[model samples]
Target: MKLLKSKWNFACLLVSVIWLASVNAVALDARKVEVRGLFKNAAILQVNGQQRMLKVGQTSPEGIKLIAADSKQAEIEIDGKRTVLSLSKKIAATFSEAALGEARIPAGRNGHYFTTGMINNQSVKLLVDTGASSIALNSIVAKQLGIDYLTSPRYVGVATASGTTRGYRVTLREVTVGGITLNNVIAVVTEGEFPRDILLGNTFLSELDMKVESGVLILQAKY
Candidate 1:
């Protein structure tokens, strides 16, 4: 698969733009806090095996207050201290929390902002594309992620560097990069291999505040 910069008719409008970008992984204390699931402005947290759903700014009976949340992680305040937590992982020691709702990506060796992130809890490489209207990937990548794209009801034609091709429109359960995450993201899966890199389109970027400084791409949650 070769890199191509072209417009997409379905959900992507990728243009010829380069961003020089990078994320530090964070771990939380598992015994005290365990994130069961994450969603927009809300999270399912299990404190001592008692699961409770908490919305932003709402405190649970266990004294855990949801501050901010995305598909990747949830920020909760306990005892007047805030820390982010992700899915089940045994963090034997306490870890530092990232900036509230913020993530930074540094450019790769190719001068493009490439980062490793999760699509439906499966890890994949992402190439940031502001021009694209929605996240885009090829069928191969979709299959690798266990996405049943062929069963989708929505099918559309997408414009790519090669030409227009058949694609499927689907909603991703979660898309995450660093500390920033979003859910129900729109994406297109093309039939053939073209977009060698998974294009992190506006469907995800529009939900965040983005800016570039000193060749680093910064993304922060809008909420």
Candidate 2:
């Protein structure tokens, strides 16, 4: 009995250590990076938690080099690994490590953009809507996602396709797209037809760097 207990304790300790290491890896994705906002003849980049402004031929302290940048995407070389980073898309933490960073989605034939997204860990189909002020979800989708809008703060008016309507603004605990995850995102939930598809609005889109190319919409995160 004593021997069995000792072995069990050791196994538990090993599992805990592995779990912690995994968590640390996710939190400290040192190689993962995204483009923030941009400017003419230059780009603002978020790398390793530091903000950097680089021209077409600039490099960061952590060894991120801006090979080229346009309205569509920024090409960066990290640790000798080169990747085309779309605005708001996160690429590998360490360049040349693996094609592990960044998320890419081709546009549909409809000429509109769409991608799979996650809200509070629930899978959702998101339609990219640049004109939208913020991410909007209908009450039905909110309930399906297990969001409690009744408990949210006082409602506010939101301008929709139909007209102005009342909506509840709440901070989403977590939102994930193409493996890039952001937390504490403010979203609006209104009554009616919003359940068909979640709108990917600027509330989250503004935080990412975005560009269009060859019928593709790319989004990259700054960090």
Candidate 3:
């Protein structure tokens, strides 16, 4: 894989972004939050394991200040930059430089790319999807991770190839792929069955810069 910007460029800004293990990883990486659902003036965001209902111009406890919003999308300021986030799309401020550099994913037999990642600290397979809003997996995957979604109030109906389905919205404690580890990542649980590999959606991919060349998918941190 090739570096988009010079390696020296990353070297220059590396000192400012390491998380070094802390609950405050949410603070250090404020962009891990995802715009799950939106409404007029207010929005539902998942920051790590907590869901926040914030209004336009209101900042959450973790420093996510809503900039603008309507039924379709939202604009917010994080880490000193303004970003317009669409419903289900995740917009992050940045990622750790040390834990967020390059990766090369070779094409699979089916012509798609596959890679290994850790979800909520457990190993799993990931299929990169630039189109999905958040990380998506089946209920069976959630059960293996010890998540009980039935009692959780954040259930929603999803449209799938099989038809309309029920799923739960939950926050993942941590998701690490290659060298990057992100906290407060948002994901969906497709109640019973879903695709075999988890869909590594925008919630995680949006934090990086990626390119496809020679059947190899290259990913790099965009801080």
lDDT of every predicted structure (CA atoms): 0.74, 0.71, 0.71
The number of the candidate with the highest lDDT is: 1
Which portions of model 3 miss their true places by more than 4 Å? 1-100
Kindly give the number of clashing pairs for every candidate: 5, 15, 1
Model 1 clashing residue pairs (backbone):
21-105, 21-106, 21-107, 22-105, 22-106
lDDT of 3 by residue, 194-219 (tens): 75579999998898888876676778
Q: Lowest lDDT 10-mer window, candidate 1?
A: 18-27
lDDT tens digits, residues 137-172, model 1?
999999999988999999998987899999999999
- Candidate 2, TM-score vs. the true structure? 0.53
Off by over 4 Å in 2: 1-101, 161-163
Q: Tell me the RMSD of model 1 versus the true structure.
A: 21.6
Provide the TM-score for each candidate, comma-separated.
0.56, 0.53, 0.53
What is the overall TM-score of model 1 with all chains considered together? 0.56
